[model samples]
Target: MVTDTDGYIHLVQYLTEHLGIFENSQQQATAEDTVMELFEAQLAAQILLVCGQNPSLTFAQRNLIIREVDSIVYDLEEIFASVSTDKATPEQTMFITEFSGLIKNLFDQEIAKLHLA
Candidate 1:
């Protein structure tokens, strides 16, 4: 979990530095959507890191990872639900798709690790 935490912090820093670029791009015009997309990406990266670290995780660590992933997914879903139709944009769809892909990749990796283990 220590490595996962370090990786998540690094990803947050990287995303923070690159957020301006992502926002300025034509893909995301509104600040709200941009912020949400950035958060989704950050969460996705954290999940990826956690999954990558799962192979060596103890039972307690596995439980922690599951809890963290569930929390992130729940929060993300709530945010998606709260987005008004007026604010709904193609960027949100793209962001969600990308985030989902990251999650799927993490799950796949974790499954592969389990098979190896």
Candidate 2:
């Protein structure tokens, strides 16, 4: 299964491929917002997948996971704010590499905890 990190990478790649479509700040802003929304949705679905795998997870635990996802999404938007729509940069690649690992490590830790419980 593709992780949210992978999904996000693909989405960014797709956006970068057609970056010319965003001719103005308004269009770029709208596209960025849409991307963030999609990432948030993907995070939620990932949470659901995790919960499904760990049926014994309590309601509170699930809620905590949801909150974590929300926090991560917020952080990601902030991190991605500097990304240029007109052209790709080294910073964009660095941001993706850094955050994708963080995202994966976070969920891996969470899943490990669930398994250990």
Candidate 3:
């Protein structure tokens, strides 16, 4: 069986390749709301994978995951605020908003599952 970290790396690689968020040309652009959204989503996935698999982890470890997720959310909010009106295309903005929501849902689901077990 694959370890949680290995699974996360595979998932991140798959998401990066299929989502085209940070592809060759895409990386040249300055960081944007969409880029931050993708980054937060990846972080959330990592947290979910870790917590979901290691329910027996120490309290400190769980707190660390929560702290990391909170930091990502804060950074994402900063990115959203800094986007210029002209650069914040409607489609891109919408995608980021939806993606962030999906990431949050995944986190909630995983946490709930842990509690229920």
Candidate 3 local Cα displacement, residue 42, angstroms = 13
Candidate 2's residue-wise lDDT over 36-107, tens digit each?
A: 444555566656667787787778877777776776666656644654333423333333444445455556
| Span of 10 residues, lowest total lDDT, candidate 2 | 22-31
Q: After superposing candidate 1, which stretches have Cα over 4 Å from the reference?
A: 1-68, 74-87
Q: Poorest 10 consecutive residues of model 3 by lDDT?
A: 1-10
Rank by TM-score (best first): 2, 1, 3
The residue-by-residue lDDT of candidate 1 on 1-117, one tens digit each, is 222444444533543454334343444445454445555556666666666755666677567666766665555455434432223245544554555555545555555656687
Q: In model 2, where do residues sit more than 4 Å from their true spots? A: 1-33, 82-105
Name the best candidate (by lDDT).
2
Determine which window of 10 residues in candidate 1 has minimal summed lDDT. Answer: 80-89
RMSD of candidates 1 onward, in order? 7.8, 9.1, 8.6
Error of 1 at 77 (Å): 6.7
Q: Name the lDDT value of residue 70 in candidate 3.
A: 81
Cα-based lDDT for every prediction: 0.51, 0.53, 0.52
Best by TM-score: 2
Q: In candidate 2, how many Å is residue 46 off?
A: 1.2
Model 3 has an lDDT value of 0.52
